[model samples]
Target: MRLFPHPFAALVVLVTLGAAAQTPSSPVGSVSPTTGLVLRDDVVRALIHESSGDRIHDGVQRLALLARDNAGGYTEAAVWTKAAAEAAGLKDVRLEPMKQGPQWRATRGELWVAGPQRYRVTSHADLPMSLAIKSGSFEGADLELVDVGTGTQDAEYAGKDLKGKVVLTRGHPSATLRRAVTKLGAVGVVSSYSTPPWNLPHRLDGDFPDQVGWAIVPPGLVPEGQPAPFLFMVSDRQGRELRAQLLTGPVKVDVHVATEEYPGHYGILSGVIPGTRAGEEVVLTAHLDHYKPGADDNASGSATLLELVRTYTTLIRQGVLPPPVRTLRVLWLPEFEGTREWFALHGADPVRRVAHFNFDMLGASLSRAHSRFLVSYTPDWNGSFVNAVSESTVAFMNRFNGVAYPPRKDFRIGSVTGSRDPLDAHLDRYSRGSDHQLFNDHGIPGVAFSTWPDDTYHTSGDRPELVDPTQLHRAAFAGLSSITVAAWAEGPGALDLARLVAVHGARRVAEDEFRARRDLASAPATGVAGMHRLARAVVRAAYQRERDALLSCVQLGAPAKAVRTMTQSLERAEAQALERLDADSKARGVSLKEPAPSEAERRARAFVPRRVKGQELASFDELVTRAAPEDQPRVATVQAALREATTALRERGEGELRFYQLPDALASYADGKRSVADIRDAAYAEYGHVFPVEALMDLFGLLERGGIMTTAR
Candidate 1:
């Protein structure tokens, strides 16, 4: 449970390594595809060399062992992280507390079959993943094993009897339990669900037989008619073998689960590298809780953060990089619940909080997971220079790595003791589901860096060895470099950042406009008129996003006069782009006139959802808990609608997906000033959905009824 064995072993400090390499800049109007913001190249080189992958891996290996839910090892890890931060010489380090209502801790869980030979499928004593979180206590022997065939559906249980028995399911364990325990009288549940195998057949549960994906049963506060649910987890191989036995002959198993639920506080860890001035802050965050060996899901992000603190503190002390203009704070905390709770306490901090960078799953090997290191900009509705600056920053890795044509030098930044392979790094569009989403929802511009489609994601198969040391180094160098500039830029430095945002934002907006024009050409004859309105909306949306990005630079210290000059240019481009699109429409025989707001838009324009003071938003389950009994049914309906919007009703979905994220976006975008129509248009521009305003009313209605929000007409 100590965060590392010798946390300082991998702390490789930089020695004066010759004059720092100066990064050459572009022409007056041109920008480098890689690293648009010019800075002291010597300092950049020092950060790359000083950050040690071994150190990050060491911290991850240690943190992975302290795997418990909020009430147990997870809280202990927060204390440990605070100590580590203090040891690394960060200022104002503190372990902030948030309310964690009724936590679950599992002490005993085991699944074994007594057939011809006594065999244990798995045990919580050893793997810690054999038990699902929030499962109620239960003990039973010789329980008949019944195959429910993906127990997520009603018809799946029509002819089957599940009472006092253990049901085998490959469906989502929660979905399965919602059916079995609440309606079918099932006593215990076993799950082997994993993502379906894709190319290389990267089926985690199949490829790694002992890996257990995390699962949770219903909380103790279920409706009166429902029995408390308990769950036992097994890998795909075990589930398959058990089903085989059931098909041949009657199979029975023994199960014991000991769990306790108690009220506790979630820990939010914070520490900062003091800046030259007070009030302004550049924030960094990563979640610190997951299952054992939740390395890539979070430990990677958590561990690498220690490296950021180490590198930055050392560089400033050694005078390699100047102290930041704004205070730089790093936070390690429990994921969603903790973030929401923290925001409730400091949602309106008077200090001019600037931007946020969230790092998650940043240590996966590209070859193993077939993953690309992805960086997301702030959502277009809340655009900031983070997207443009970060895109240009990480491009350094992609362009400078491996061999190239024209016989250029390979300036790869790899670890001496880590994998030295070509990195599959890319810049991505805005994505949800990270700490950054919370910051953006709270009104700060934020970006998240991560790797996706990880092979061992959420499975016990994720271990320290699965993390590539070189990958950690890559993330630290790129992440630390961008944030340091954000926190440090002023005067000329701020101007450089503005220029970066202007050029990149222009290209990005142009790309969105091009797509709109392309879609316009293919609009159906009957829908051409509507398409014109849609195209105009797209142009207007693009203008807003890019304009926001340009404006964020002033916070970093860009001159107002210069920024105004740049805005005029963007306005001209916007007008010209719209004119060109209209000209193309005339050529295509659409001959459409500019349109006015439709009836739905008018309704949206008049209504807004206003937040109630100190009434913080929580997760779907917690929100249900807040509602009165009569309103609970409405909460349930809204929860389903929310799921369909963000997750397409399930983690995996059918057919083509539209802005299924409308459910997630509405609450975040309901910042009092935005009319329901403004929220809808932003959602349409960010995601390709032309939904009716009525589709979003259920959530606003629920929030207003719960006293968390008020709808103003």
Candidate 2:
């Protein structure tokens, strides 16, 4: 039966339920005066009490059984996902066909060392990851093993004959296969690129000493007219043993890989919870494809999404919660490829998509996997209030589940079955890896929920036993609460969200101010102007972010009074931040005003900036490689400088080293309508600082020389 008779009826029911759920003591829809947050006591209580970790665990267990090895596995996952969603009473459950690349499946594979003391190594029948994905079929063949440490560079294979041999290397399988097997005529490859240093002890001393991880053979990387080579990943322990044997004398091995490639469609399982609004929707997504027993990597995420569906369905059916005003759409698909295909088909009409919440690797056991839950924000290019909302929800959950100050205090809100360990989740800057990247690329604001530093990630050791049900429960709650509040936010709830944005904005401004001060203090006199420019730019970005948040509330149909109040609050905060920045500038004797560009600089600005399209643009590695022959000394200097800069940036909490300042920011401003000068000026307006004309010229010249940009006209 339908949950509501009509759209209007659904709206009325939601309003009525909101009114009924309120109480005098802790009103459900009341705004907290101190925190400026909506107190959704009823919804929080329901989520805490009704959400089931056991159900999440059961789903992960069932999914763990599926090998998910081929197109068949992908189809099987879709079928099961559809069935589960239907059983949960979700509406419009169906499988969407995604036509992308050919399907790859490993039917059988085995490896053994035959010479100088023979022994069995591993088999695909035992562990799917033993054979890398896209490995070709090969019968039993005795090939000598050659040690070519990280066979990616030509120097590594200078004096070696790798013909008809199995190359052993510690580099990525794809890179090694391309260089060793395809170029050097090796029969196969064995890679031992294990987990990071933190996970070394686990593999060395743990029960799964022979555990391996999955690798891929990229078709694009192979030499033209040469078929992809067979590859396998083995444990570091096994690899070490083989290398030791090779040290004494030549070691021969028998390798067999049975695999097939065929055409197949990617599957996307989707279930909808219809709401009062017809067009507007919020999507919850999780990838379902992975190696066999891929529990912590992705089975955990899929299971959490399934549990969320069941909980929402049950609550609505039981009359404990009303239907959302905006439709809630849950989707399961393969990772990047599937999401890309989905966008290719449905990207034209994305105006109704409120937000996309992506879940990946959300159930790793902290003690075993050394995992930390992370909620990554949307990129600055696609800034919205969604980041603030999601971050706030995670913080709220931490209050109850986070490490207590006094220790062992019962601070949890509602009774729920799971771990009492602190929620220890952190908010991270935007990164590109999973399905969320595709959404963000299509102009949709999205967030990704994941656990990092997982020792068992993407490895054979990522079994269902490594999943923590409590982690799953908490992740599901954060996602559900954020999306639910976003869908139903109006009146007091909308006001509270605006306030949340204001608070978050203030904190962000403070962080920028701190960074500016540090940069100014450390910069040399010659570089002081650039530093000041960057600091001003940071302030401008911060205020713009606040404005974006307030505008998002307006888009959400928030009450005018609430939006006005929030806008004024944001303006006041921005003004105060600017005043402080000016005061600091005066104290530092730095000029805030920019000088007018000379005629030469103005002429330089006339050059239109257009990003290069299509393939064959040289990669950074290729650039370094090509430069080595022309200018060895220059290359060494550049490399050393880069290393030093990287070290400094890492110390400053900037995880990745960026040699150029504001590459993405500059690129964002390089629309066809904007000239180089126009783009620079606009960037300055947005950032409150402009790079020196010479610096801008050098950046644009480099882009043009590298074929990454060109004159539009």
* Clash counts for the predictions, in order: 1, 1
Worst ten in a row by lDDT for model 1:
21-30
Relative to the true structure, candidate 1 reaches a TM of: 0.87
Maximum-lDDT candidate:
1
lDDT for model 2, please: 0.70
| Deviating ranges (above 4 Å) for candidate 1 | 1-35, 153-155, 196-210, 220-227, 402-410, 591-601, 608-661, 671-674, 697-713
Choose the strongest candidate by TM-score.
1
lDDT of each: 0.74, 0.70
List clashing residue pairs in candidate 1: 645-660
| Cα lDDT of model 2 by residue, 50-169, tens digit | 776667878888888777756787688779878988988889988988765678888788889996567888888888778888788887556889988877787889999988889998
- The CA lDDT at 524 in model 2 is 69
